[model samples]
Target: MKKVLPFVLLLVAVVLALVFPSVEPVTVADATFDTGDTAWMLVSTALVLLMTPGLAYFYGGMVRKKNVISTMLQSLVCMGLITVLWVIFGFSLAFGEDIGGLIGNPATFFMMKGMLGNQAWPLAPTIPLVLFAMFQLKFAVITPALITGAFAERIRFNSYLIFLCLFMIVIYVPLAHATWHPEGILFQKGVLDFAGGTVVHMSAGWAALASALFLKKRTTPAHTPARVSYVILGTGLLWFGWFGFNAGSAVGAGALAATALATTTTASAAAAMAWIFFDIFRGKKPSAMGACIGAVVGLVAITPAAGFVTVPHSLVIGVVAAVISNLVVLWRTRTNIDDTLDVFPCHGVGGMVGMLLTGVFAHQNVNAGNTTGNGLFYGETKLFLTHLVALVVVSVFAFVGSYILLVITNAISPLRVSAEDEEAGLDLSQHDEEL
Candidate 1:
């Protein structure tokens, strides 16, 4: 019944897709469109999409050789699975007509009904609405992929898929709507998440923590990474693609984008340096993995403040985030919770630091569009306090919601591989293949 039910539902969706083709009247380039902005957005969308494959490599290299293929597939699968869901109604659920200041109406853009025209999202007026939606689709794709790092090596493939879908519906969509939707509760309260410190990183990070807690520890916890070179390559790709993730959030190829790009570069560099140096100071050899992870933490830390803070302040954000996350990683090692790859410490804590620092370093001089008053550094308490409260709320919601979803998924599909399967390795046991 379980296997048949999935096939049946997919058949229904297939029938529906064929029945409802997106044959809306297409409009060629309209006068309202700026070629530069549109061109940049097109490039930006492609760049962000590349990050998922990059993530696959990043996570794949960290697991044992037996689980390498399984781990990589988890990240790659989101590209196929989430994109279909996004095109159907996921976009509307995150960006459609406001629903009581909490969510978007799922039917607002059913099957992208009205997207073929010269329409533009209110926030991104230069590009077609469809372009904006596609850009956001990349973000949606990579988020659940981020959580994969925590539960890597032990999760059932089918159960992971179910949990991924449940996560998007219950966790990612609501947070996206609440933070990015103009009328969203958080947005209205002046939460200035320039990219996705709160939306993408924080949500994925807390969910990773929840998954680590719920899944407990692996049966064979002692293992070494399969390929450090793959991790390095993945980090390079992620760093390159992140230019689009942060700078492209400006939604235009203007000064703001340039500012974001500069800040992203500086923050990441500073973080890499800090991470390796901090390790050396601790009498540990400065390793390539440390450098790559540090760079990513920097990237995560500066995501929310990229467009809103100066380059120097971005350096501060990066260094502070790296040091803090390193400490948390050290602490996690001392505890019983095996967060497989320390997703919570690096992404979760890095995101929290970024969000709070944005409240401290953001200023109108950098981006006059900030109606939210100056940050704490400029003697404003409102912004910082608002972020503090939002941080707690987001933490609780993501952790609790993800834990519940894990329980439900376990009931349906059994979240873990069997003991024999675990011994055989997920690649051979689950996929009938081996690296």
Candidate 2:
């Protein structure tokens, strides 16, 4: 059944891709598309897609060998399921015309009806509407995948499948619309989220925390990571792909992309260093796991401020996120919250650090589109205050909404595996496979 399910999903995806070609029936007049920008977006889409596999390795390495395949599959399945959903209506609900400023109007681009060829997306005016949709698809694909690290090795596969769909429809899409759409309530309020600090990381982070709490602690308290090397490799891939994740948000081959690329690079490097140093301070050896986690936290922290802040500013963002996440991980061990891999500390807390710091250091000079006003450093209070409000709103929405979805998913089918299956591990019990 597992093998057949994947194959059927793939077949549906192939058909969707073939049916939705690079041609549109209706074209907008005077909508100019640039070849250079199109070429850049093509690469960016592929790069963003690579992050999912990178995430699989990241989460896979952190679990026991008995559950590695299941851990990785949790990340991989989203690529298929979310792609099908996005093409059908996820894109429309996220980026289609506004509906009361909360979500995209479903009728605007249902089934991707109007997105292709010469049609230009208002967000990325220089790129094809289809390309923009595909690019955004990558973002939607990875957000839910990030939450799997929280409840790894214990979740029922079928219940998770259902939860993934609900999370996207009820949580992710609305957050994306409210933050990214020009007419979005948050966007109109002058909140500046250059690349999903609020929309992606914050939402996923809080949900991860909620999921961990709802699932309760693992029956066993201690478990070992299967492979540290895999963690290192995953970190490298995530770091590489993040260039596209952050810079690609520019949606053009322009100066903004370049600045974002520089900031992303520096932030990760600085965070990695800060993380290892913190370990040294705690009288622990500088471990590869710590390094990788630090680097990823840095990447998460800089995501929101990548385009709005300068490269040097990213150094502070990275270091701060690493130090704070390190502290949270320490605090977590003292509590009963079994966030298996510290997903909340690394992503949720790191994202908050980045979002708030963006309010502190963001500069209009970095990008000429400075309508959001300057950060605290520039003596402007509006942008900083607005980010605070957004942080609170997104956190509440994600935590509460995710809890409800889990309740619904549990009602349909138990969310946790049976005690016997969990004891045997998800790889063998859920999928009849092992590495």
Q: Which is the leading candidate under TM-score?
A: 1
The TM-score of candidate 2 is 0.95
- Pairs in steric clash, model 1: none
RMSD of 1: 1.5
lDDT per prediction? 0.92, 0.91
Instruction: In angstroms, give how far residue 354 of model 2 lies from its true place.
Output: 0.7
**What is the C-alpha lDDT profile of model 2 across 128-184, one tens digit per residue?**
888999999999999999999999989999889989999999999999999899999
- The candidate 1 region of ten consecutive residues with least summed lDDT is 22-31
Model 2, position 421: C-alpha lDDT score:
92
Worst 10 residues of 2 by lDDT: 1-10
